[model samples]
Target: MKIGEIAKAAGVSTSRIRFYEREGIIPAAERGANGYRNYPADLIALLRFIEQAQHLGFTLREISEVETGVGEHIVSCTDALAMLAKKRDTITALIAEAQDRKRRIEALMAELEANRPAPRAAG
Candidate 1:
């Protein structure tokens, strides 16, 4: 397919597809005689995978690791799992920190409420 067709089918802009090719998130496309990009049909699936990974909070670097693994057969399930476990731990810590912050804010609100000043009598 042409770049425009693939971009439309993949629900991404053509520039984004170009960016992915440049970033090595997707394999470089073959150039036609007119210098237009020619992408494979399977490119849509890869784009979807990237979009889903991003939605799951994976960084572009992390997505690039998976992309490179799929493209080059360099990463094993064991390696991927180890990475996922580390990400999970990081996310867990962040959640805990957010909860702590929320609790502190709630406590401060309660204290402020309890110590509210009495209203003066109307003149």
Candidate 2:
């Protein structure tokens, strides 16, 4: 398949595919005699996986690191799950920190309000 064909099938832009290739997130496409990139048909599935992973908060670096028989995106569901769990843990911690900060801010606001002085009467 051509770059545009795969991009259309993957619901991503052609430049995104090119960017992935450049970033080593996906294998580089083979160039044809006419100088057009010829991508493997299986690449569409990989592209979709990449998009879904990004949507689920997986970084490109993380996705690229998934090891398979071919060395990327085939042999390791466990690795992907581990990455998901790690991301979930990070997000959970951030949420807890944010809640703590909010509680402290609210308490400070109440204390300041309670200590505020009465307004002076108009002259």
Candidate 3:
């Protein structure tokens, strides 16, 4: 597939595809005799995975680690599981912090409402 075709199929921009190539998130494409870039069909799925991982709060460097590991046979299942567990713990902490902030805000709102001044009567 061509870059544009893969980008559209992956629901990302062609520029993003090029950037991914530059960033080593995706492998470089093969060039045809006519100088057009020919990408593998599997790149579409890879790009989508990148997008989904980003949505799930995974950094490019983190995503790259997993991608590189898969390609190199370096990261074992135990390693992958540990990485996921760490990320989950971070997210859980963030959720707890956000919930705490929400509770504080709600408490402040209630205090303000209770302490509101009485309305002035008309003359």
Higher-ranked by lDDT: 2 or 3: 2
CA shift of 34, model 3, Å: 1.4
Write down the TM-score for model 2. Answer: 0.87
Clash totals in order: 0, 0, 0
Top-scoring candidate (TM-score): 2
- CA deviation > 4 Å runs, candidate 2: 68-75
Off by over 4 Å in 3: 8-13, 41-45, 67-76
- Name the lDDT value of residue 53 in candidate 1: 66
- Per-candidate TM equals 0.78, 0.87, 0.74
Ranked by TM-score from best down, the candidates are 2, 1, 3
- Extract clashing residue pairs from model 2: none
lDDT of 2 by residue, 1-123 (tens): 998899998899999999999988888889999999999888877888888889988788877877634434654688767878999999899999999999999999999999999999999
Poorest 10 consecutive residues of model 2 by lDDT?
A: 67-76
Reference-based lDDT, residue 105, model 1: 100
lDDT of 1 by residue, 6-122 (tens): 989979889988898898888899999999889988778778767766787888888887633334234567866787788889999999999999999999999999999989999
The 0-to-1 C-alpha lDDT of every candidate, in the order given, reads 0.82, 0.86, 0.84
